[model samples]
Target: MRILLTLILLSGLAAARANGYDSLPAPAPAVQSVPAVQKMKITDLQDLIARSDHPLIINFWATFCAPCNKEIPYFQTTVDRYAGSGVELVLVSLDLPDYFPARIAAFAQSHAYTARLVWLNETDADYFCPKVDARWTGGIPCSLFINNKTHYRRFFDRQLTEPQVDLEIKEMLKPAP
Candidate 1:
């Protein structure tokens, strides 16, 4: 009976420790505000794209994706470089709903990520995928660049390097023909 109770207790403790937020480092003071992770549907994203006045990059990523984690610093660097230029970089997280508003905020704060963070509260990939990109296979670390005023648009549904991100930003800023 003692051994069975010990095993059960250990399992419970393990589960409590693994509730999606324990692995992330503790938050730092760098992030002034732990903003609410806005839950966005496909329609909300469409409105964001349509109403953006300046160049915007909506980067779809998830906390569990290794490649997505790797690309964030590169994207953040470019975002900082374009500061005050109205070149916006929004990091749209595809993390499950369970991790929202707190765990995700802690992860971003720990990493000191300055880009705007939002949670894409979407479920069906078939519905939202084509709205972002026709070729999107629902793979993350993808980015969509858009400037509504210029009618400029571009999409990359793969891992992007820093130079590619920089160049993409520059491309978005160009006057459309």
Candidate 2:
């Protein structure tokens, strides 16, 4: 009888441990916040391009890339210049998820950038990159100027200057009809 009781208690203990209920409490609900700058999923970007009448300028960058750093101020200036013109300037960081918050905050603080900043958090680069553009080649310092479905312009594998950015924004803002 003693042996039977011991075997029952042992099995109960094993079951409790397996179920992870021995000590730990239930997980807390995730706290969500409104992001100061909106992040985009692949679908969200695609939909924005489809639905918006305004021109969308997207700049892909990384925190560690030197050319990206140099060009960010130019992007910020472009955003400011185009303010209230129905144009959207989006800065998409390709930095890894672990470094995202700090890098984004630091960049925003340093440049005083008002343009929306987003960290691309999806891990499957091969799948997501082509969705943005098959010609992306997974390169930083790439910029795209899109005006509806009919007009899409992309600059891959290059850094941009303030004047160049301004010129592009001006070109995008020009009447297409």
Candidate 3:
């Protein structure tokens, strides 16, 4: 019986080797989970806006808004299209706190989104909304195009098309006149 068991084990090992499965690689060490989205209060956003030296596109989006979802590709393509221009883009998430990090992070990761991602940590829109735009009525799919040095700034609060994005980027990159 002992010899039979040994033969069976050796056969199994030989089969593994024959199939090019020579001893499996060591199991990967356990890894801790980390949120891909960073938390930032509205004030941090304000600071970022104030400090940007190059043209910036700050796109406000959420997991639940259909329009927001629709226009993501426009912005993502803008990211790739303008990568050589030194212009920057950030996708700031406003997903509800209940879903928070998981749904939003998964959305970004699943889509292979390439822009910098952030989650607004504030709950009070009354305080944060105006900081983004004075006329803002808590809209999704909104955006801010800003250049601190050129003092060029524009804000849009509706779904954007690729042509509109292209025009806006060209306008934002125009030399201050």
Candidate 4:
């Protein structure tokens, strides 16, 4: 009986390995400054809005999305230029949970991403979409711009350019009309 139990466990482990479930996480770079990737829930996002005084840009992306990949460079450049403008950029990954730490970390490191990286932990689009925005139809490469001070917020459901985001930020920061 013990032998049979041991054999069953070994076969399960072998199956997991074959399915890439045993993949190792990417190693941290020698001079990494960005904070480690974190798992985020809807409540955490609410907390972010409540605590921040600056304009926040939260971008939703995934590893498999082509438009999401294309917009990354623009997002990176925008973050670099606005590093001191009280503008906060967050890259929220919608990648599979199984790709966490390993695939995601490697990609971030390779790109030398400067913004905060987060993995949206919810799998159900119906449960997560409403929490972000009632009109959000669960699209990849989406972005949300918010200024808690003025209660001004906007949502983009497609790829965005750097200048477009910059202009929006400039407008959002203007004295209320």
Candidate 5:
């Protein structure tokens, strides 16, 4: 009886292996077709901020802002170094709505900015600024760090350096209380 039962179980195991039940599940497909700059609403931003599995670094900038332009390369370097580390970088463009083809897209393509790029569609800085951060004065070159898992958040209203971002990442990685 034992031998008969063992043979039946072994055959079932072999059938399951043949049907791929022994292998790890496949990974989700990569998102390779995002728009260069999707129009993002405040609600969209809130949802992004609430993601708990990974840390997010959001840089607010515009095409015409000189300081914002200068900091792009540094942020790009951060993106490359932190790839696959559960750290997401988003360059939020505050460019005027009409500048997508003539300025925004051209500038992003020219710089080869590979990080996710989004355009905050709201124009009323006074109303939206407080939504982002109470201390924000609607400044370009601002960077916000959020780690929902740890409940850590930070806001920087000026341009950021590589060192500053490194420090911020360390803070974001600290364990939640």
Candidate 6:
């Protein structure tokens, strides 16, 4: 009888852990610095793109993705390089809603990333993936650069290097407007 009771308790514990009950505490709510660049739905982003006359760079990433974490510093550097410039660096985190705020806050605090970080809280990746970009295969570390109706550049399925980001930014900043 005791052995059976122990086995049941053990099974319950394992189930809880499997369900992420044993993970870190829930993340706090995110405080928005730039109200203009708040968490946006797909349609909202499309509208923003339509209205904005400057270049826009969007990075898709998640906390648990190793390559995503690795390239965060490079993204930060890119943001710093273009600070106060017409370019807008938007970071869209693919982390689930439950842990998104806390993880992103911690990440931003640690890395000192001043660019806007927004959570992509939509649960259906199948639906959201194509909305972001048809070329994206729902992969982390994907990026898109839109040059104010002149060009739309996308780098899907791989991490971006510093030079690569710099080159893209330079291309976007070319004198056409």
TM-score of each: 0.82, 0.69, 0.78, 0.78, 0.76, 0.72
**Model 4 ranges off by over 4 Å:** 1-35
Candidate lDDT scores, in order, read 0.78, 0.65, 0.76, 0.73, 0.72, 0.66
Give a tens-digit lDDT track for model 5, residues 1-177. 223323433454466467764443333235433236777987798788885478888998776566777888877787667776688888888765766534565567656677788888776676677788888876667999998888889999898888887777778777887
RMSD of 2: 16.4
Off by over 4 Å in 1: 1-22, 29-32
In terms of lDDT, model 2 sits at: 0.65
Poorest 10 consecutive residues by lDDT, candidate 6: 1-10
Encode model 3's per-residue lDDT on 1-177: one tens digit a residue: 223323433454466457764432333334623337888999999999999988899998875555776888878797678888788889898765754576676666655566788999987777887899887776677999998878999999888998999999999888889
Question: Model 1, residue 123: what's the lDDT?
Answer: 69
Of 1 and 5, which scores higher on TM-score?
A: 1
Clash count, predicted structure 1: 0
Off by over 4 Å in 2: 1-37, 149-152
RMSD of 3: 18.0
lDDT of 4 by residue, 1-177 (tens): 223323433454466567764554366667874347889897897798778898888998765555776787787787667777777888898776776756776767766666788987776777777778887777667898888887878998878877887787777676665
Query: Per-residue lDDT of 29-110 in model 2, one digit per residue for the tens?
Result: 3562223545667777677657777778878776555677789887777767777877787788765565457546454554
